[model samples]
Target: MHFSLFLGPGVRGPHEDRPAIDLMIEQAVAADAAGFTAVYVGEQHFNNYEPYADGLTMAAFLAGRLPNAYLGTSVVPLVLHHPLFLVERANLLDQLTGGRFILGMSGGRPREGKTWHKHDLTPEQRSRLFDQKLDVMLRAWAHRAGDQPLEFTTDDEYGVMEGRMMPASYRRPHPLFAIGTNTPAKIAEAGRKGQKVHLGPFDPAGAGRIAALYRDSMVEGGHPAELIEDNLRWLIHTKIILVGETDDEAWDVAERLFTGPMVMAPWIRRDPGQDGWSLRKIYRADPGPFAPAMGVPESQGAFLHRTAIVGSPETVAAELAGYRDAGLPHVHARFIFGTLDDPEVFRRSFRLFTDEVMPRLGVETIPGPAGDQVQIF
Candidate 1:
């Protein structure tokens, strides 16, 4: 089982004094020192959803510090940028990182906090655009095989290479590419193309449903056996995590630091028109059964239950073992969220996880592809 730390803080409001970038560097360095497999950052913009607006650049910045760990963008919205630019940047990072970059991409959501002139695209249009842009990127990366410079033209997008795409990616064709989405059809398509996937938070049973779909489609699509095996091995699932001496103690810390701020930030700030409801609106209308006691809606508790692994080391390790047993091997854990007033709380939980939970899962330090391990400092 591979564990990746999510380095970006999911902040929702202005916090110029938070020193988020400094803390992020600390987390990356800590993860590398503790032997985490990889570290990832999500691309969120305009709103203070995430401290870093560009995940790829952030990954590049961390690359020098993470000698023992790979770097990845959890989900870079593909529709927002031209394929040529995206591919060039991805290739540069792949070359500089000694082939340790994973480009996880998405079609983007309709309700992005950042406003683009092309915001009016419907879901279908966005899907098609994502597919088209991905094709262009793949072709550009593979153009080295041909003698002629690559030339291509798409709707309102065109590129005529002056010479071969410079600095070929360290990984042939491209660095490891993974699609980020929970939609079954998209997941199946990604599988058919022999690509890995980053799924939303789900239990073993829920994850198995899509996991099976991806595997079956990979086979049904007639991809080679090795590619199928590789795809399955790299399946990623995201989760929120916190560890303490006991479940009750962890829950106390969660309630004190995580729940309320989460409710206010990312959840409440979501577009009210999104699915015709927002968490803030629903909470105002009715705080369900345990809301009064929990100080947030029962819905938020349920969300946490479905998406997080909060407990003592033993309990957390058991749940993760279940995920590995059920074929969800790569866990991308978000250890810090909302406006955390205490960085030590994050450091303590991270220490507990790496020292206790990670050992139970059999995580061991492995050499990077280049066979060099450099300390961050």
Candidate 2:
């Protein structure tokens, strides 16, 4: 199993005297020293949702520290920027990191905290735009000057661009690319393109369907039949984790840290209307069961049960073992929330997980592209 550290404080305000960037760097430094495989940050904007609006810049900052771990953007929203710029920046990051950069892509969510004049795009139009941008980026990275023209025109909203991709990406055809989403069609598309997938934390049954669709399409897209199942390791799953001596003790830590009265920022926040719902609504219509918990203790536990792994080492191993058996390629452990009152809590969580559970599960090092590892096509 591939183990990783996920850091992106969802909330960024008034919690501690230390600056948000400093806190994140501190966490990254600690995780690197402890030997976590990779570190990923999410792209969130405007609202105090995440300290950094640009995930690329944050990853670049971490790359400067140049830990042994790989650096990735949990996802960079492709719709918000021009593809040429996005690809150029991505290529630069790959060069800067010497091929260790993983470009995680996404179409973005509804209810973004920031206001974009292009926010009025219809669902169908947005999908088309995402496709166009992705095509442009891939062409640039693939150096497809013969297959595609260097200059192209896009919608007025994004504008036109022309330029040659001079500095080639460190990795041929660019560094690893992964498209993350829960939608079956998207997963199938990823399989068709031979790319990795940052799959959502769906239930086992839902995940099964995703894996099946992706694999079938992958084979149909010309991948060798023998390589089909072996490539399932790319379904990078996300989970919040905390360890303790026992289940009860673990629950206490979860409740105290996660469901505090002041209500720390959400570990993962996705608003409604971003997926094509009516924009007038303020709160999410599909708040889902967990989103509307209003920061209550019971609700927090329910949320964790829905998406986290919190328990003793033995308990955590039992649940995660089931996940591995179910065909997940990797696990991204989100250790701290925006509201963590102190940094020590996160550091301790990391130490315990690595010390106790990793050995039992036979997780010796960061994930490599072998042994059922999900391939980034």
Candidate 3:
């Protein structure tokens, strides 16, 4: 049951009252102190409105800020960059962090391709590009692994492979690679590559079904049968966690901050012709002329109560048993979502979660305040 500090930062929101760069740095430091296993940030550079234009840059900032805990991207949109460039930068980041880095990549949306890609590729083209780019990046890492600089190109030609990757990645066989996906085929593909994966929070039925799909495919893909379970352990289920001393308190905060405009900020600026328009409308319905609007049903109090764990420490621990039953080995806890503006509040919520919920969930914590024993970064 490894815990992680997950952040999906957007350009708009009340949290943006403070500059995003500063807030993320502060958030990373807090996670390290709280004994979180890792800190993951997103790359949502859909527009000038999106806060994190470059994930590796933020990954570097976090690597510098935290004494412990990993720094990783929610995803690097691989279709947007050359394989060599992405591999070099990521390997360098891993070296700088002393191997405490995780690499995650995604196929960018169509609108993003129109804006940033060298050519206007369709979604299918971008997906192919993602596969090709990632294939080259992995090969580059493998080439760097042996310090090999052989001039001959392989079946999959990566243009201009002149020199070995300097400061070779610290992680053996390269740092952990996680493929982001929402489909069963992609899940199987990630397993075929023996890479990790990221999926959204799902109910027991959904989670169990997905897990079964990945396991069966991994075995069929010639992944070592014995190691299939080990690989599945790398499946990170993302969820928003908001717990306090009491159920009422936790529920109130999650209901208030994690909804409506704050939750919808990331998609508001997207091209209307794309998926963002549907989301904008779905999340836009709650606002009114004289009243504070709530967000889309997904983030609202009732929906979240079922989909996410939002309760007191005791309740959170109990609800998590279902996830454990479904064989989820890890969860990326999003304590810093929506309009959670105050750092103290974030610290308090995380501390309460660590202090109480973690123990019941089989993780042992030394009885004391967060960062009391840990070195300040």
Candidate 4:
């Protein structure tokens, strides 16, 4: 199994003045030096949750710094940009990264309202537009594979290509494609099309079923055996990870690291008008007077137990072994997130995991540590 680093947005308190981008750079550089397989970044806008506003831009910048590891977007919102522009940028990254780029995409952030979109597109409209855009992008790339370039039209955009797409991708056809989805239909369709699916932090027990659905559907859809094997080899899942000298120490630190600022930032700022409002409201219920009024501590505890892998090196290895045994081929470790202020703590835990735990996984990793090799500008 491959272990990669995922850089998500974090909360910076009022007194914390360091740029979030710097932290992202630090994490990516460290991952590269540590011999990680890949580094993925998240895209966020308007909200201060994510470190960067654009995933591709961050990936491009980090690609230069991370020569040893593959770079990809955890997911770029496909519906927000022109398909043609996205194709150009993705192809550029493919060339620049020496074909070590994966374009992970998603439908736009429907929860953020339409403020960032050019028009007020409903969720259904956005989903349809996403499909149309993907179709156009793939068709354009198909020209490189000897397919005739034909005229294409989306809801508000149309274009015709007379020849091969400009600055052809480094990889034939295009860079590897991935999408983050929980819907079985979407997962199966991605399998049919030979793209990867990111099963984000879902329950491990269900992951086997999802993985089976993907591979079984791929076989049923008549995709080649090599394609199915490669997809299975790179099938992605996410887990929040923290390691310590002992399991108890890890959980204690997790309660401190993920409890107050970590959980509250997103919960308080989330779109109340969107789905799961009532469920979130219960977690944010009134603690009454004379109590620490905030998101429920027990809720975060339960969340850590289910979603995060907080334990000693031995424990972490065992938990991850279960994932590998369950047929997950990739694990994206989220070492940084909201309100985790101490970079040194992150570094220590990351080093411990790399030095002690990864060896037991029996997966290939770059040798040696890259301490202080991180560059900043």
Candidate 5:
């Protein structure tokens, strides 16, 4: 399966003596050398879960640094930005990356709205807004003089004036548009549009439902049966850390590193009433039973395994094999999670995965621009 790396600058740690930007660059450099296919950055604001307020900027920096790797946003909160401005930023990044940019759009989370004290929109409203913004962006990218006109007016001395975005996107028809959400309708929409879907750690049954929904929607949308096979790219995001000699050793290291101070500080912690519920509760409350006991009993491990690709290279490989069998082609490994402070350990795990697991799976290691390979200690 194709491997992608997900970078969370804020979640990596607080902005201390070493700026997060530098660490981000270092991670990109390492990931590129490790021969990963793509690197995705998430858009998080006000909170420390991810420090990068603007994913487009970080993506541009990565694009410049790692020429061989594809750069993408895990999901941009489209509802937060004006469609025209967002489209412009996307086009610029697309050009900067030389057509290696993938646009991942989402309706955003309810907590994010609360952060800005913005009105909490209903799911339907958010979806509608998402659709409108997407439409505007698509049109702007495909803009020509006679095609259509997008008009915007501001309160001033003068009346309204017509306007249209200039300098369309470099990619013909537009850069890749992938929908990032767990909603069935969104997944179906991606299938109908022949775009990719981002799947995270969910129960195997849930995964099957997502896949089936996408496939069914593809057919219902009048897409050819094989369209799903041709263009359907499943981007699975999972917490993964490669272990060394024994699974036990890996578990010990993971628990210590993940639960450390730098990694799970106030920023990463969930605040009541502010950070909504669901995932925040999971993070706020115990990381769950399996998480506390690093050993991870089979039943609990099975549950976690559904969402995270952890353990030794062999173990991770076996799990990945199942995903491959289930029609997932792309896997986005989130190397940073919880509160892991030691970069060296992270590097080691990543290196081991590259050296051991990927090769056995018949996945070729394509170096990023720097052509650096990871060496396990």
Candidate 6:
């Protein structure tokens, strides 16, 4: 099983501010040393909230620093990028990482279009655009100099032309492809193409259902049953906060991190009775008291117990085992979320997991300490 870490560039806010790119470099070094198999950086733009605007760029930087660790994007919003350019960037990063790169693509959120003054595309449009972009990217990666032309159409006009993408990916036929979505149709589409699917929001029950759905769809779509067993990789991303000695301590840390100014800078407005609101709505809401308070200590404690891998290493390992039993092939830990900015806290939790949890699961550590600098393999 692969153990991955999901790191955001940085959240917005003066008090919750992170150091600089240098800090990210340090964090990558730490992750590599702590024995993480891979690292995924999420992409965000416009808002000072998320420092990393280009996941490909960050992946390249980390690849240079940690040659042994796989680098990937949690999900790039393909609708916001020109397909050809996105492909080029992906290809270059894959080459730089010596094939240890996975590309995850997503349709941009409707609110993002409004932020950029672009027309808000419908779900069908986004789906079609995602399909087309994938086709172009795959074609660019697969074609050879004398092979078939890379062709695509935009606005009903077709164009055909291309040499192979420069800095061709080290992986044959390009690096792995992953689609991130909560919908069954999207998950089925990915399975039909033999692509990996990332499951989310820390819901194990939902993840199990989605994984089963993908496998079932793969068989229904004429893929061999063995194909599902061989090619499918299940990645679950979850929020986590580990406490050293007491549950209260863990709750305290979670509240501070989640409520930190940087994380909540663009506060999310929650309905009085609803659990939470989406980030898009949060960004659009006025900064009034109506903006929901961060999860209380007790509520947070319940959340951690329910959705996160927290507590001592033994406890965390047990929780992880439950996920494995549920059929997760990879688990992506969101160690840094909201305000959890203390380097010491991050390193300690990472160390505990690597030293105790990972070995118990019989997975090999990627090799290194928590913050050692790396070079691309």
Top TM-score: which candidate number?
Answer: 1
All candidates: CA RMSD (Å)? 6.7, 7.7, 8.4, 8.3, 8.6, 7.6
User: Model 6 scores what on Cα lDDT?
Assistant: 0.63
TM-score of each: 0.85, 0.80, 0.77, 0.82, 0.79, 0.79
**Candidate 5: where is the Cα deviation over 4 Å?**
9-13, 17-20, 115-117, 146-148, 152-164, 225-227, 260-303, 364-377
Task: For residues 91-159, write the lDDT of model 4, one tens digit per residue.
Answer: 888778777778888876676646765457875787788899999988877765356657889986887
Error of 6 at 74 (Å): 0.8
lDDT of each: 0.74, 0.66, 0.65, 0.71, 0.63, 0.63
Give the per-residue lDDT digits (tens) of candidate 5, residues 138-226.
66665665654554331111122135454456566566667787767677877777777775555445565667777777887787755
| Candidate 2 residue runs with Cα over 4 Å from true position | 12-19, 144-149, 156-163, 225-231, 260-302, 364-377
Q: Please provide, for model 6 over 150-258, each residue's C-alpha lDDT reduced to its tens digit, 9 standing for 90 to 100.
A: 7787532357866666766666666666787767788887777777776554445555666677877788778776557654544445445453444445555555565
Candidate numbers, best lDDT first, in rank order: 1, 4, 2, 3, 5, 6
Q: List clashing residue pairs in candidate 5.
A: 10-51, 201-307, 263-339
Q: Higher lDDT: candidate 4 or 5? A: 4
By lDDT, the better pick of 3 and 4 is 4
List where candidate 4 sits over 4 angstroms from the true fold: 13-19, 117-123, 144-149, 161-164, 260-302, 365-377
Weakest ten-residue segment in model 3 by summed lDDT: 287-296
Give the TM-score comparing model 3 with the true structure, all chains together. Answer: 0.77
**Could you give candidate 2's per-residue lDDT for residues 1-377 as a string of tens digits?**
76777775555464542465677787777767666667888887765545677889888888878557778878777777878777878878777776777888877765561366667777676677777878778766765434545655455344434445755666765667788676777778878877778865554445556667887889879987655654565467777778877876766676566543223334544343344432112121333454322232323223434466777889888887877776774677777763556667767777778888887787534433332332143
Worst 10 residues of 2 by lDDT: 277-286
TM-score of 6: 0.79
